[model samples]
Target chain A: MRWIWFDRFVEFESGKRAVAVKNVTLAEDHLHDHFPGYPIMPHSLMIEGMAQTAGILVGEARGFSEKVILAKVKRAEFFTLVRPGDTIRYQATVDGEVTASGASTTGRIFVGEEPVGEVDLVFSHIDKNMSGLEFPEENFVFTGEFQALLKTYRQQGGAKVAL
Target chain B: MPMSKDEIFDKVRATLVDALSVDDDDVRADATVMGDLGAESIDFLDIVFRLEKTFGIKIPQEELMPRDILQNPDYVVDKKLNAAGLAALKKAMPHADLTNFEKSPEIDRLAEVFTVGAIVKFIEAKLASK
Candidate 1:
């Protein structure tokens, strides 16, 4: 099963910088009736972009050996409206860090140079044994553009989709 | 095995021919997709999706339509594009990297790639060669 969180990680790296791309398109079903005449990338998805980017960081910190979730939003700020045909660029820096249990990341979304959003994100990497849980990947699978999009994830040096 | 430009271009073209319904003669090496083949905005995006599926390559929107790729084909064959076409698709797509990607002010800038087939072929060639 494909995971939507992995879908957003077009690029993920450790210390320097990481980028995630969201191609806002009209075909996304969620965009179906958002005022008909025009479609927009919802603010929530932008926040997800940050969360996904942070998840990558968490995955890296944890050696990607465990499942990770944003777990909490902490703080989120939307700066601009992300529209179809525009690529939302998400970048994150390690604002502060602790052990693998948790870390705080300062992230932002930009449509080109224009800053579209900012997120102060927090994530938890849980051990399945410790959490006593088994979550199906299909349950978290996103549909439409997000699902098709999940097939494409890029690393900065130019990589292939692992899935 | 390392891939060659012609070989990559050929594979990309085959997929485009199927998806965009264009003849081989129409997709020239230097022809602009939006300007030459007459692809609409949706078609261009569809081509992108298909490219992702076919070659296992994800083209970042920004890299797909980079100015130099059309005006100059050599730019598409970047080392990373050759090695990580899918990741390039995901990472290099225009909106994702504001700093490194070529910025376009034209809202209709996307509409300019005339043929979806060509754009797919172009990106595919670049991505496969690495």
Candidate 2:
């Protein structure tokens, strides 16, 4: 699984919340095609980044017993366009109790100290048996790449998942 | 000192409302936490954590829901909870409403009995036990 949106987790607090960062660079293929003269991060990918942040939080809340998928975007607001070299910080907070059907969360996207976007999202939790795929041994909280990034983050003084 | 039933109910109600985002009126004592208030399985952890914080109590994971009971070969048969499993569950969750447990004593169905009142009673009993 390629986690193209977010690169690393800065802080992960088990069931409560998470903070991640994505650094936009000129090498990204999407940026080149998004605009010819003025290449910028597409707003859609920004929303995806926020959803991934919140989805991971919800999945961790359940101890990866359930597959958490982004079901809906309750609300989303954007403040500015993201350009290469800008670092997008995603902070996701789980709202209410994470249920089996899904969880609700609000994510704030920031660049430096300025707020760029915010998203309210709903995530659905599906059990592995219900999803109908033969059970394969895998990390439930994140993809293998993301897990490795988390380990690096932990080594560099990042917060551990409280669980 | 142990809290009064009403005190425990009030705290449990507030915790459910905050954790599940349900209305104050919806968190009645007899209201089913998962069925009526729309709490999902993951919500239980948040509810348990909030209850512990609000009352300053330690609720062990097994005691709270006991999903591990499904692993017992004697307790489970045909991928369902057998009679002995139900009895063990009754002993484990005396504070829960297991009155209709025999109707459908499947291991997965165990979460249905975790009503708000049951949680309050469980907390009360736990506090009293100490």
Candidate 3:
């Protein structure tokens, strides 16, 4: 999957929680089609941003051995709309141990301390061979770019994992 | 010179409520941390951290959860907790109330025994030993 939602990790504490930022800009392709004129950020994309933040946190806690996927969103509520030039910050906290099969987390979105959204997300893990087809490691989306981005974020004083 | 059971329970209850973000009334003696009180695995670590800070005690991870012992093939037969494993757990965690746990325990449900009272007892025993 493309790591499109979050831009960088602001704070990460492994096995506990994480904070990431997503910058919304008018130059993005999604903003044009989401609305012909108004151009408000899509809530679904916001949720995906939160999920990606939580997913990385969960994966790091498990030493990146398991393939984590979003299973369900138990709860999601948005109090405000996001627009271009507004940076959305997501804070995700793991609710439990990230087992090989499943895990759960809670995420909240903010714009400079103003709470805009909150979500309770459940995730499922599948083995690399679960689909009976083996793809080379290089074919995966979490490759050089992702690692470089994570490294940059880590230099910002974020923990190695999620929190 | 350890805390009274009531005192221990009060502290444990507070810790659970704070860590799990559950209501104070929900953290009862018989309330299971995962089921009734809505605590997940990550919350256990938070709870342990809080307990360590509150009581000034250090609880090793292996002793606190014993994941290795629980998952060992020799200690688990056909996904059920073997007698030897159960006995070892009983000895290791004398503070927890496992009286209601099944004789042939399901591996996943083992964490259910970590109720609010169980944590209180664990802290009580740890403080007394120190």
Candidate 4:
């Protein structure tokens, strides 16, 4: 299964905030075994959705130069279960300055107008922060597929977004 | 007015509690951040972010951990910090009490230097400098 969680970037304000939407469906294979009858969306996947939403924002802030990996989930609290047909909206905002070492983001998940969860994440710029470790020279974190999401967003008249 | 050591410690304690998900009682001054508080490398960045937000001060990663000195070949010898490395660490982290670490400068034991009290001291110094 593809790891991409969110379906598309609905709103993106580079370096500051971004909003992405994920449409949950019964066709997702994992939901079938998660509970035969219930088939409720898992909270873990919601966290991954938030991670992708915020991780992209953090990565784009630096022009996707650094391998922005989700280093830590400071907090992930869910208020309700998401089911099939629920449109999960992830709104992520950079908490402060995206330093060379890493960036911190606060995300709010919503199903329509109802608040579902909040996930605070910390992203490390491995190239800059991991002193002794060596990563691949190519920008592996923001692969073509991920960059294409941003490209499509920009093409969709998101011209105001700062790259 | 500058924040006192006690005030700094309280905030630092709260930051660690939030960053590491530890109970308030567990955040003792003598407790090592890694060993006692169970803070991994990633948590250090989380702590830095929270501390920056809490205290409204900038903490360059190097100032807190000094990974550059630890990784430098000139400073490390046989998986331990040589005299030069120890000196560099001491200079980098004046807020940390390295008296015990100085005895055995093993690369592995470096995390022991990051006690709750040491963090409090680091914040106290940073706030004073601002």
Those runs of model 2 whose alpha carbons end farther than 4 Å from true positions after fitting are A7-20, A24-86, A91-109, A115-134, A140-163, B1-3, B78-83, B103-109, B128-130
lDDT of 1 at A12: 50
Choose the strongest candidate by TM-score: 4
Candidate 1 TM-score, C-alpha based = 0.43
Query: Residue-wise lDDT of candidate 4 within A120-156, one digit each (tens)?
Result: 9999999887777888888889887767766775687
lDDT of 4 by residue, B60-104 (tens): 988998888888999999989999899998999998999999999
Highest-DockQ candidate:
4
Per-residue accuracy of model 1 over B46-128 as CA lDDT, tens digit each: 45555565666555544655433322323334322332333343343432322222343222343443333445445545565
Q: Give the range of the ten consecutive residues with the poorest summed lDDT in model 1 chain B.
A: B98-107
Candidate 3: Cα lDDT at B35:
88
Worst 10 residues of 4 chain A by lDDT: A154-163
How do all the candidates rank in terms of lDDT, highest first?
4, 2, 3, 1
Which portions of model 4 miss their true places by more than 4 Å?
A156-163
Put down candidate 3 lDDT per residue, A1-163, tens digits, no spaces. 3547987777878878899898899999889998999899999999999998898888888766566767667578999999999999999998645554446788999988899999878765544213334655552435567677666655764553332
DockQ of 3: 0.04
> CA shift at B35, candidate 3, in angstroms?
4.5
- Computed on C-alpha atoms, the DockQ of candidate 4 is 0.86
Question: How close to the true structure is residue A42 of candidate 3, measured as C-alpha lDDT?
Answer: 91
